[model samples]
Target: MSSAFDDFELKGHKLDNRFVVAPMTRTSADSKGKPTELMGDYYARFAEGGWPLIISEGVYTDRQASQGYVNQPGITDAPQTDAWKQVVERVHKHGAKFIMQLMHAGAQFQHNEYTDTPIAPSEVKPKGEPLALYGESDGWKPPKAMDESDFDAVMQGFVGSVNRAEEAGFDGVELHAANGYLLNEFLSEHFNQRGDQWGGDIGHRLKFVAMVAKACKDAAKGENFIVGIRLGQITVTDPDYQWPEGEDAMIKIVKALKEAGIDYIHTTDTDVSRKPFKGGSNKTLAEIVQEFSDIPLIVNGGIDESNYEHIAAHYPNALLALGKKALANPDMPKRLKDGETIEDLEFAMLQPTATLENEWQWRDEHDKHIEAD
Candidate 1:
């Protein structure tokens, strides 16, 4: 029986084990998108607890407009880059690898910092405004249809950000192309309704994604800078949403990423067991996608001991990512290593908004409030 404790290697980076700490949004950064010191301690805790790779919460690439919420972190400038070094050092201190996840909210942005409208691949108005965090709500608005310059920024911003990440001492960078964000907007037919070269069919939809991949890959010039993308089976806009080109589209996308010299691909969904779209083989989505490349593959969402055991029994090559389970117990990986079991998931334990001062105890307090409801 294959277990989640097995070692794995990808692109010359040797992981301690298959436990991947999946990213989770914690509204704890300062106004300028620099992670607070407490955030560093938060991440280091995971490493201390024994996770192999810690993929951070989405960090915007642009200074002002790249945010989905007011408190999200950014890596576009010196202060932000300099600030992340502490996080990297802390994670590495505990013998775990760290990766920065670059994300652009596009039309889903819900902050008032920037005066210009958000940018997207098309002018299609987002169906619902992103819910406000705390009391902030003035930035909710539709996005501007991206022009050539916008696409250039999409490519260049990612390039610059990943370079910043590399400079900050992160082991790698993961592009957040999932969850109906800017990248997914371009990739989904339900969100993007443009007729230009950047949209329409699956090939065209992938153009921007491919451009970003090349830029990120190029920016990873020296060092074993790992560059990968996190994608999902369905768009966040709708549970039923899928690639416009059908299920096999990801196979093509994977080939393109491999050709671009990407190091890995990460996948997730509401449940990893969901059969998202019509595809070639009857294998699980992760199985079919992994068949496309020898690059390391990561599958996340609802992963616990039982899920990991089942998946490991079948797809022994896939890495398991733990999200809520990790949150419920930061020492989860270590516990499993010690021959313990995962605790029951407590969804109410997550804080809708977290701050450095409060994040440490937010779960306990919130669990009291939500569980009572």
Candidate 2:
């Protein structure tokens, strides 16, 4: 029987354990999208507490319009890279590997505040309104479709961001291909209706991601940096999201990434126990997807201490990513490893709208409002 703390190798780097601190956007960075001292402290806490692999929050590439939220970190500039280096150093000092998630918001952006237009594969409007980068309003306008030149520029931006991540001392990079970001928009038929090489069939739709992965691998020549891509069935717009084409699209995309030399596949599903299809009783989404491909898989979303043993036993090769649980209890992995009772796990710390300063405050207030009795 293998323990959660057992040593594991992923994408060429040896990890102290199979537990990874999945990427969660705290929005604690400085105004310039640079990591601050507070950010360093925040990440260092997790490393010291005992997370073997820490995937940083989704970071913008180079395109200004790609910035989806205010204060979200960016890896495109030198100062930003320098800021992230401090985070990497702190995580490494505590015996953990850090990976940066390179992302582009694409059609998710609302106004021209970041840029005149948010680029997308087609001129289709996003299903719902996403928050503006700077304000607290609701109505967001649709983005203009991208031309051939614009598409190439975005690809270059992704490539450039990966190079900067390497310079920042990250152990590897995870393309933010999962969430309803640029890559997800391209993958979905409802969003990407282009008639070019980047649209039409599944193969064409997967071109951009493949190009980005290849660029990252080529950029990190001798560094042996682990390159991975995060793919999922959910997007912000399509919350109850499912790939209508079933696993066929996923299989094709994974095959392309494998050919591009990507080392791992990070699959995100809101609930791991739920079957992917309606009536067909089959393996979970993560299991089914992993079966189709031959790369290491990191299963995230809906993981808790109670299910850690069961998950580890069932999916031996998959790494479990704890989001809200990890945020509430930074020592979760450590507690599990020590076989300590975890019934007091903080639940309110996972509030999506609460800030770091207000998270604990809100939790305290809520606790006071609700007595143990």
Candidate 3:
């Protein structure tokens, strides 16, 4: 079977390898919402270590309420764009393609922290209480339902972000549509109770995504910028948020995305091996998306070296996106391609601080060992 190191052409870009570094929030940016030198060093290390495609952490759009976490990177203004330009240049120099995952936190915001009320398609509260960044403990508050004006503003915000991303020298942009964010909120009937064109049934529910896609395409003009969407089987807030409409809703959405001219579709599941649809079948979401979409498809979640061969054998054209695995072993793609076993590859720890702490500790220990030598 072809390994993760196999080179493939995705959206006209010749990716050196099929293993993509999935976007994981580091919250390592400075207070100005610009990436810091340390953050740049961290991502550059991964690129240098051999990940072919590195999808940067979720970057907040222009909306103030879109700031999901403290110290999360933003691509809102000129300085942020300049900072991202540096990041893109570094990653490209290291022979890796960088895509900015543009995201709006939507109603998933902690009202106590950023704004008094988070705006969503509907005035629906998310499942659980919101946690503050790190040690802060202010709880959750119900979000405000977005009116027509708010919706228009959000669309404009996304468009502005896309323009900024292109200006920042990113190779492409991935719309963060998954994880119970704004797009997902619109998709879920529970969250989206609007009677307008932006809500209601599946067709209307998908309008937000369609609008965003069109806006992004318009902002980029005719640039060959890759536009991808990251969609999940279930959202974080609603683990039980399965649709009674089954794969039909998902199929319809994929068809719509394909029609929208998106370059690729990135599907996420709790486990890559698990089916993305509500049914507990072995048919993965990538397979289903491929059936519906004419564009390329990338699959992420619970991917490791052990399952690489199996996945490759089964899904030939599918690109595997590795999150925790990439974090733990930056050279994992090379290792897998070399036919080396990666059962012992370190698993990534949860939360940004923990990841930073572990990386720092390991660096210190390695430095001391080098000194001893």
User: For model 3, what is the error of residue 70's alpha carbon versus the real structure, in angstroms, after optimal superposition?
Assistant: 0.5
User: Candidate 2: lDDT of 366?
Assistant: 65
lDDT of candidate 2 over 1-373, digit per residue (tens): 7667778888678888888888887666777888987678778878887888899988888746777776778887899999999888988898888999888888876432357677777887677656432334455556778887877778788888888888889988899887678888888887789888888888898898888888778877445788888887678666676666676777788789889988888878777676664345465667765677778888887888877777777777878888777776666778777887654445455345434544546656767221110
What's every prediction's RMSD, in angstroms? 3.7, 4.1, 3.2
Better of 1 and 2 by TM-score: 1
The residue pairs found clashing in candidate 2 are: none
Quality of model 1 by C-alpha lDDT:
0.77
**Consecutive 10-residue window with the lowest summed lDDT within model 3:** 364-373
* Candidate 1 segments whose C-alpha is farther than 4 A from its true place: 132-140, 279-281, 352-358, 363-373
Error of 1 at 115 (Å): 3.6
lDDT of 3 by residue, 3-42 (tens): 6667888777888778888988777677778897767777
The C-alpha TM-scores of every prediction are 0.91, 0.90, 0.90
Distance (Å) between predicted and true CA of 305, model 3?
A: 0.8
Model 3 residue 214 CA deviation (Å) reads 1.7
Which one wins on TM-score? Answer: 1
Global lDDT scores for all candidate models: 0.77, 0.76, 0.75
